[model samples]
Target: MNAFEINGLSKVYENGNRALNDVSLTVPKGSFYALLGPNGAGKSTMINILADTVRPSSGTVSLLGHDLFNERNWCKRRMGVVPQEIAFDPFFTPREVLRFTSGLFGCKPDEAWLDELLDRLELTVHAGKKARQLSGGMRRRLLVAQALVHRPELVILDEPTAGVDVELRRKLWDFMRELNDAGTTILLTTHYLDEAEELCDHVAIIDHGALLTAQPMRALMRDIASSYLWLNYGQAVTLTDADHDALAGLEPRSSDEGVCLKLGRSENGDSTFHQTYQAAVARFGPPLDAGVRSEDLEDVFLRLTRRAGGDDAAAECKS
Candidate 1:
């Protein structure tokens, strides 16, 4: 059975902004799913609806077979959410904060579990420090721990690693993987496409309050089928319109020192594009240095968003 399911979920704010438009998706039990999109793509709105922080304008949400809107307590007990914003009482220590949060959920303090959480999150030594005294990264870690204090079955992390240091980010990824491996369902909304590519098993990309696509990470990446060729040279090279037209399947654009060729979906791997790019470099000799590289999730994201037009809100959500 799916851990969480949303059907025809739509949310329109009081200001007449359609935050989410008929967004529907399901997350299987114990699966790691990433909801990716630019700002104003309705990521946070969807999450808020799931967390019961906001009510949807239309549609339903079912978590573990229970209707979320109606069965608020039951759903709240089973799901935990780490929001994008870091919010906590500045005066409380990490342990004190978590203890208070757990009590609010009617959960008794589990010192052992709490200690283990802090240890894993690298906040053990800082547990005694006030929330205001912790560094930005430490505060982020504390937010994650606070969500897990009740040991909920499903956890939603909204930009959990944003503004965090590299080491802390890596540690959080590892912790999340461990949770998923232990049968906890994880739903992540992140601006970092690379993080989504590395951690999520399934992905759903949204744009302008609409669902663009939902599939396994591998399948989504495969469907894009695009690559980038970066050309570097000792001296600047000028190309005529005819020269650009010669690389028909490739979209060529000028860079600071050299040109960049963006290979289309139908184009094959480095072999064909590499040969053509090399030929172009050879023809333009003296100054051109060429390199062909496969595209990653970021490229796929850009292409998808661009295809949807430059929706500024969606773009802002991405960061």
Candidate 2:
């Protein structure tokens, strides 16, 4: 089942700005998906379209089997969103906020259910605090809690952990994971690639209002196929002629941590970490120490977005 099905979604503001261009995506039900893009990559525009807060130029959007344009009310009722900015009134208490939000969907306050949400999000202690009075982290948690007041099937989080403490961020993601495990779909967008890598099951990269790639995290990362081999020669020594040639093009960096060589992942690369360490030994010979670090989500993100943006910029500049 798809929580969201969008095709050919495009939005062009009257100011001659194209917020989205031919964007298409499908978010699976009960999956934690990450929608990543650079600043002004049309993420906010896309989110607004999904939430029905903004209209599209040409496209179709469906939410949990409900046509967003035709069955708008049903679609809106089945999804929740935690926006990047704080959207509540400062004077309102957490309890009051949830009460008002749920009421929007014609849901009367159920004390037990409300309490459960507050507790699950660890907002019980600050339930009575005004939004202005709560700490940033507390306010962020309250934002998420209110989004769940109506028990929506899909939850969209835009930078949910921004400015949050590490411990609190971990707790928040843990709750999000639990919600996903229990069948709620989670769609996240954030500048933090590490966060997406840590929590998302699938990832979609969009740039210049266009979709770059959408695939399971592991599958997408497999394309990188690169790692770093850190080596220690025991004592400071110059590279032998053979050593220089063998390590050529590795962009090796020297530091106290030893010589770090950028390694291109071979098609026949080792299948396991232990095997990788052994392979490093075979390539670099014995050293006082050696380590391997693979390319992470950040690496992939930078490469794809930069390439896409560069190409788009050149074309736009030509005219």
Candidate 3:
């Protein structure tokens, strides 16, 4: 069974702002999936809906084959959510917070598991410190530990590494990879496209509350057989009027190392890479070095979002 099945899901806030359109998506069981979007793409709204914090205007959702509305408690029992915001009781220590959260979920305190979590999250040294005393990164880690205290089958991470250091980020992802390898399904949302590209096999991009593209990472990549041809001359090449006229339609980006031209098919299904490259090479002389840089997730994201006219406003009135 799929981890989640959402059909025609939509959310409209009280301020007459529509946060989600008729969005339909399915996340396969045991797969690491990414829900990607711009600032106001309704990703947060969708996460809140799944966590039962926000009510959808209209939709049907199933978690692990159980109706989210009819079997709400059942679904919640099997799922864990790490929110973007860091919030917890100021007086409670890390250990106390985990224990309390576990109890609320009807789970007996598992000291061994708790210790393991603290160690894995690098919070063992600060286990006795109050929540308010911890740094931003530590608190973020605590949030993750709290979400997993009960060892739910499905884990949803919304910007879990927002404020963490690079070393800690790598360490956290290693721990998460271990958990995913042990059969825990992960759903991640982050502004870090590289993170999503590296970790997730399946991806879905939303823009302005509308579903833009949802497909396997490999399949999505296969549709774009394009690359940037980087030509590095020994010296910088100055662009003249003659050069500009010759390089028309190539969209050349100049750097200290000669010029880089975008080589791809046009919207009308015409490939100009070979034609453009030949003409530009004849004009600018042979380069000292040359290579091709393949398009990545960031390229795909910008292209799709730009096509949809997405803006920088926060979605659902939440950042």
Candidate 1: tens digits of C-alpha lDDT, residues 191-220: 888889999999888999999888888988
lDDT of 1 at 45: 92
Q: lDDT tens string, model 2, 219-271?
A: 99887535666667754435566666665666545545345566564567644
Full-model lDDT for every candidate = 0.82, 0.79, 0.86
Candidate 1: C-alpha RMSD to true structure equals 4.5
Residue ranges of candidate 3 with Cα displaced over 4 Å? 234-257, 264-279, 307-319
Among residues 3 or more apart in sequence or in different chains, the pairs in candidate 2 whose N, CA or C atoms overlap within 3 Å are: none
For model 1, give the 10-residue run with minimal summed lDDT: 310-319
The TM-score between candidate 1 and the true structure equals: 0.85
Model 2's lDDT to the true fold?
0.79
Superposed by TM-score, candidate 1 places the C-alpha of residue 16 at a distance from the truth, in angstroms, of: 1.1
Q: TM-score for all predictions?
A: 0.85, 0.83, 0.86
